[model samples]
Target chain A: MKYSILASTLLLAGGVAVLSGCSQVQEPAGICNMSAIAAQRQLAAAPSRVQGGESPLLEMPLNSVSITDYSVINKLYVRTVNARRTPTGTVEVYAQIINCTDFPLNAEARTQFYDAGQAPSEPISAWKRFNLPARTSNTYQTQSIGTQSAAFYMVELRETK
Target chain B: MRRARALPLLVLASAFSLSACQTVQNTAGTPTQYLDPGSSGVVRGVGIEGQDIRSMSDEMMRDLLTVPALANASISPNVIVDAEYFQNESSSRINKNIITDRLRVDLNRASRGRMQFVGRQYADMVQSERNLNQAGVVSGGTIARTAGQLAGDYRLGGRITSIDARDPRSGMIERTHQITFEMVNLQNGQIIWSNYYDLRKAAQDDIIYR
Candidate 1:
């Protein structure tokens, strides 16, 4: 009887170990604490939310400038971004980009506007190209064209491709 | 000796036949991809492109909205946008309708009743329907018929011009395109609003724009 009980106990232990291993694999270790790169990818991969849909877990701040190309990050940076409504109620965004490198640089940028609820308000703006002299600042300006109120905006920049 | 010669000929024929039976690579061609119309597409040239048309029209549309006499007027002014007066003097071959059509459509949607657009291009069709209604061939519409078609207060007219330079030795070409957009007061013939877009591009060779 003791030998039989020992065998039964060993089998149970083996089964428990296999189940626990699976549980560990499926436990979602980094879900609550995602790295910055992973979080960025998640935010970009997620589709734009509808008007009343659930908000994204990660979102870039409103009226912010994002340098999407890492290669351009060290070469240039946005100095200031100003967004305000024009007299006609359209949202206008202006940004100043400063080139840090000693050589002249060409960069492109586009803007996406959002409504008060953080839903995209208008079609994204066309990519505007600008040339920056060495160690100089260049201004970039764009406005949203829609009847919908544009309460927020984000600008993305990359090296001219 | 004849059997030996026949064996050699058969071997040579078999070698040729075997070479003919070789397998081909059978590679696949590139799949089609959708690109944003507002961004630079894969095919580019030293002339005005689709992105240029979109960007320029968008910019002008926003500018037109900011004018007090147009968008925020007490009574929305009737505006007619068509390719009738818009001219293209550039070397690049582009359908002029592409620019005017986009501008009118986008402006009409964004205006949202703040401005009115007259269907001047469909005047003949509208006139035919009106004649039918009057002749009793078709029943009168539920709404009351007006005595005359709507008249436009403002009309859009523009011109596209370009300058081209070519290098003799390097075979390089440079092109500069200047497109001007203007809204004219139909009654006074005064240009109430005007804007222009300019771009310069240099390239060695480019794909044909069709």
Candidate 2:
């Protein structure tokens, strides 16, 4: 009887030990690291030259020209002289057109003048359209009219509608 | 009385033996929560290849585009970019084309500028023509100038440098990536803007583990 009682007690104790080993808990998945993304966004928001500066052409005489009954579109001015000549005459007159808001300005938009006059009386000269490069500036010269040169020449700036 | 006394002693001895047996059996079975405490797994080496370096560099380039120098430019401006020169001083090998392509895409998206492929394409064509001449194929450079040429007022150029080193005590590895981008006046070659970014990552294991 005593031996049987001992065997029962041992069996109970073994069952308890086995059951205790079965209880366990697991952890969940972790979050992804986003430090890189945050850093990139901060960099994007940092100030740059384009955002802080005024228009590069604001100080030039061209800025003084009034847009009278004319819409301002795209504008480009380039200074090119006949380098072959000894006393290089800086051709200052640039082509101007009244309406360019509807279409893109091309090389054909430059105006040509034969003589110094408001009206196109004789087709002695032709104006050629110019395109400006990004992040750079171009300078255009005005026609030299004897001793009294026009302070400013009008160039049509094309606007893309 | 003797039987009663022996009964408790026998029960105690049996209980001790049973607990020991259960402990051994529990250890032999599959562990539910914990890994094997006695196993010291083999430490593996990390392998960073040329492509991995290129990928990391590309990602860094994309991140760098957010810098104001490239971001503040008007979207419709013309842009020209010279091919990047890759000079590798580190022990790791990397592809130059990967860096160039990344820069191209990043700048294009950031500035809304058009790229003129003519200069590089022309140079390539001329070089190829020369090669063809040596091989006896007669060809002249007759490509007409197209209106869509990437002739921007500004030109962007830059370089990439990388460094990788291992820690002696902890055995941790670190990688450093650096890139510098500069925008210059196309006509005058004057640098108008410049910026650079550096990125570093440290990993406990040199190699990625699954």
Candidate 3:
């Protein structure tokens, strides 16, 4: 009777130990360390060709980098890009960010402007912050002072903890 | 004697088991790390912050770039920007120059000679230099000699005003700020380009705005 009781108690303890490990499985999802960067290239206006031709946007690239947070993937993304070169030979760009989350998020972003030679342009923009309300988005607009030198650009977003 | 030895061993075994339980259960303390302000600055009660300054100036720069008066073939219009016109009529006691300086410096860099800025704040130094040059104490470099100080084509001016209301029960303070920026054409005395940025902040009196 003693051996039987001890065996049953040991089995009960083993079962409790197995059940306790399940909570750890859920925690491995862990805290979100996810962020995304979007890049856009400014194309010269095609004055001769009709506007209905191949969109300059198709030539522009949408790059996703260092994505780890799957939970917030649908929560935010680059909506569109509008870019133009000024008569003064400088470039102006507007990057729209959309937030699909149900809560407000303070998103931060920075941009790198590059020359035609693929060399980084001077005075790379500092990281700028934006406040996004739930289910809404906003445009972050900036420009390259060296419009003649700027041929490419990249916009980066980071998990602003 | 045997009972005493057994008791010590039992206590040591219990200690090891308890430590194992603690190791398994102590996963709650996730540590925090510091982040750069340019990347992720700390946020306080909804107030004007470094992030706000960056975003505000960036938006203003973009808008100015769109307006021909500031960014087109208008080869560098001489302009004046100062805190006197960019007043803080809001409850927040922020330095008004912070806004104007950022806008001016960033625009100057990004405008690519499309916009020129004059420092009315340093008129004294300019007058001193011109006076010395006129007196022949110091020779003036030849560009195009002018009779007097160069006049600005447009004067960048605006006001930062606010409206404050209180929640009766919670006593929480909700403050709204309307920051307006305009570039007035000096010749015609008309506001050529004008826009306003708005922000609303609410919190208790204990919060600091800086």
Candidate 4:
């Protein structure tokens, strides 16, 4: 009776392990925490929230709007960013992202240009990818394709697989 | 009674096997998903892929639109994208037309009247139609006709070239492709704006590019 019970217990344990393995996504050790990356990305995109001072999104009220991002990239911090209206009247954006983690992270971001009236431009910008070295800063930039049509802009960032 | 008892056991075995079988003749499984063409393609080879084409064209278009002269010029620049001037000097077999077409089409759509595309290659058909209309054989086009076709202010052309290296031991091959784009002033024959995009990729040369 004990032998049969032991065999049945072993079988149950193996099945449990297999089931767990199937559901869990395998990522490199020590860098799999997506929540931390999400935080950083959100922080990098926070500059769009600043109203009236420097950002080209002149239509939005100060401190009332923030760039929306993937929930997990909230940790990506913005070192410095410059946003302005160019000679062509389109919004131009340049941003520096600081990676606080111990390992390199591959990330992608895209910006959507909107008219002052909060209307989104047709066909969102392509997702541009960049590599951030551990404890280093990476720069990303984009210009609106439509000249007079772009007044306000919002950027989204996420960790790329 | 004996036969009845054997029949139940046989039925039980068949039912158990059917329930446990992994392969079924006709049943629904996972529905297929799609991949973005700009980044990925159905075919994978040692040579260039869809991502390269998309990235190069996108970069070229972005840079081309940002040029100040195109808009600042006194007259709206008439742009032409002809295969004759755009040469493919690379070792790989690629459809160079795809690159030029994407750039021209996207730029034309987004330029907002700042630039105009001249279909010079289709001039023969246009000329033929013009003659027919002027001769009163056919009704004239809705727009008024000019004495002659408009000349292009700027001509667009480029070249696709490559450099390659190989490791004999590991049989790894690396190739770097350089795609250069330029807009030249039609009258002065001077290059107004020039840009080059290059990428180096290494992979085992197991499959052919074509």
Candidate 5:
């Protein structure tokens, strides 16, 4: 009888110990919080204003010479070309224009070639304007304007005000 | 005598086992923390903290520019916005009406618009209209029409949403919240512009205790 009781008690104690050990082992792992970083990102992504007044030109009326329904003649284009004689052979020029506000633009704006002193040189009427409707956009080829001339050249909007 | 002694021993063992079970149950249960009203700089969760009308409005105003659609368009003249619909989500503790008020202020500032509050007289008008409809005295559609007549060109409407979840294995908690604002052209029922802002926060469960 004593041996039987001893054996049963030993078995119960061993089972209890095993269960307790398992429970301890199953305890949840620690967690690392990342809430702060998320909050920071949100704050950074938020749109914010830098201090400045509105542009003055936005309030002014757009100048128009004629009310003829015009299309956008040409969109802006820029390119570089090589000068034959000069060591600094490369020159760059940008050209573009809106054809008409009303009709679709047909011809691309031409690069009216000019000399160093703003005089007409090569009439590369080779540039053609394209049709662009009102409130629309168009693109044209970039021309190398002052490649060979040793004199400096500049491009400007030519339509008379 | 031997049998009697073994019975007492078995009872004691059973008692020990029962106590151990109770301890495990108590330890495994979830624990919660409450906000201390007196605590300072304890950043409240999205909707728990009292609404900061001024700050919220300012933030909303600034975000208006970030909308890609508006970037290239000509800037609009500032207009005034009155509160349309501002309420807290069901789960939030914050007062939703206060949020709406703040939004009005914020949008006004951001868009350079003004805000005009509907006074007590208008409130009475709305209440009377509600009562009339409830009593079957007037058509429900008339209420909106009457309100619009009193109000102006645009109506601002918005909603807020939020989610909170905790991961048991990682002991990580994440909270996400968003607000969407829309401007409706009342006459045409067209949505002229809409903006949305989302905020997310995550912290380890342990840090929550800290």
Candidate 6:
């Protein structure tokens, strides 16, 4: 009788161990370490389906204006994003972001320019910090230093870290 | 039952004794790693940093490209960019060459055939080489040599100034750095192009900028 009781206890412990491991398996590695490019590709593949709330989506073609931090999806919104060729023959990227929250927000953004072949045409831009007043909008703009005729750009936004 | 109760006491006593023992990790010292100079890394300070140098240079280069007087001149204008005229009036201990060199190099690369950069910093080396060739000690290679060194149409001049403040009670340090860049016409002493970058930073932990 005692041996049976001990076996039952051991069985219960084993079951608890297996259940704990299964619960942990659901939490995959964090997306924070992933590169902006890879994150954009992954997000483009399987977009969110939540109703009434819009997740941070690529605003422009070739995945421009990506919010790197997932926490800021609801806190910030990209109102407009555009790219154009300057008179000097270089490309310039501009994005207007809206603050969704009542509190002031500070975010850092950087840009990477690519050529027609989808290769880096110029060095990545330094992180530029912009402040957004509560419920207001702010614009972030950067110009490419490349003399290349055709260029594409990706701008990444994240909370000041 | 008694032994089991005593076991907990013994383990607690042993743990207390062992807590005083110092231990060393098995791994080697911190490994050298590379970080992007264009982005903020672990070490940061209130003064100007690598990212500032990169961004200011890049901005200047792009803005200069838009100016027709320089980038769209009838003939490629020879510009001299050196640390001779770039002054660091700020208290920060930084090598001025780091900023001017980057600006000159980036401008030269992106300018394509629109502009020219004269190496005023290396005039002595060029002069020595020319002397050797002229003295018949060395042969002048393929391309025909020019008469003399080219004169610069515009020379880059800039100043880095700062306003520093410290809160006596809170021990907070605030610094505002204003970097001004300009291109001057050598003959008429006219400021053809000018731009300035301003940044203000506050921090509590004192970081010595070397």
- Candidate closest to the true structure, highest lDDT: 1
Candidate 3 C-alpha lDDT tens digits along A1-161? 99999999999999889889765654221122224333332333322245566534322232212222444544676667667886555676677777765578766666677777657876667656568787677886666667577887766665444
Consecutive 10-residue window with the lowest summed lDDT within model 2 chain B: B35-44
Interface RMSD of 4: 2.3
Interface root mean square deviation of every model, in Å? Answer: 1.7, 27.0, 2.8, 2.3, 25.5, 2.1
Ranked candidates (lDDT, high to low): 1, 6, 4, 3, 5, 2
| DockQ agreement of candidate 6 with the native complex | 0.26
lDDT of 6 by residue, B94-209 (tens): 89999999999999988887888999999999999999989999994886899998899999999999999999999999999999999999999999999998877888887888
The backbone clash count of each candidate, in order, is 0, 16, 1, 14, 29, 0
Model 4 segments beyond 4 Å from truth?
A1-77, A99-107, A131-135, A158-161, B1-33, B134-136, B205-210
Q: What residue pairs clash in candidate 1, if any at all? A: none
List model 6 lDDT by residue over A5-124, tens digit each.
Answer: 999999999999999988884532222322443445434422335766565763444536888788776677776789877776677788998887768888878888877876777777
User: In model 5, which runs have C-alpha deviations exceeding 4 angstroms?
Assistant: A1-161, B1-40, B46-55, B63-84, B106-121, B125-149, B169-171, B204-210
DockQ of 5: 0.01
- Candidate 4, residues B1-210: lDDT per residue as tens digits? 999999999999999998898665796787876878655455565566766676666666666777877754456788886665889998889877778787787778777687888888789998999889889999836898799887988888789899989999999888888888999899999998898877666777476765
- What fraction of the reference structure's interface contacts does model 1 contain? 0.51
Give residue B7's error in model 5 in angstroms: 38
Poorest stretch of ten by lDDT in candidate 5 chain A = A58-67
lDDT of 1 at B135: 96
lDDT of 5 by residue, A56-124 (tens): 322111111111222211221122222222212323333333332334333323334445643554433
Span of 10 residues, lowest total lDDT, candidate 2 chain A: A81-90
- Candidate 5 per-residue lDDT over residues B1-210, each given as its tens digit: 999999999999999999887743445555566743222234544343332333244335434434333322353422335444544463445555565665554444333222333333266777786777768897748324443324544556777778988888887767776767776666777776776555555666333211
- Point out where model 1 deviates above 4 Å: A1-59, A146-148, B1-19, B22-28
**Docking quality tier of candidate 3?**
incorrect
Across residues B68-184, which tens digit of lDDT does each residue of candidate 1 receive? Answer: 788888999999999999999998888899999989998998788888999999999999999999999999499799999999999999999999999989989999999989999
Which stretch of 10 consecutive residues in model 4 chain A shows the poorest summed lDDT?
A58-67
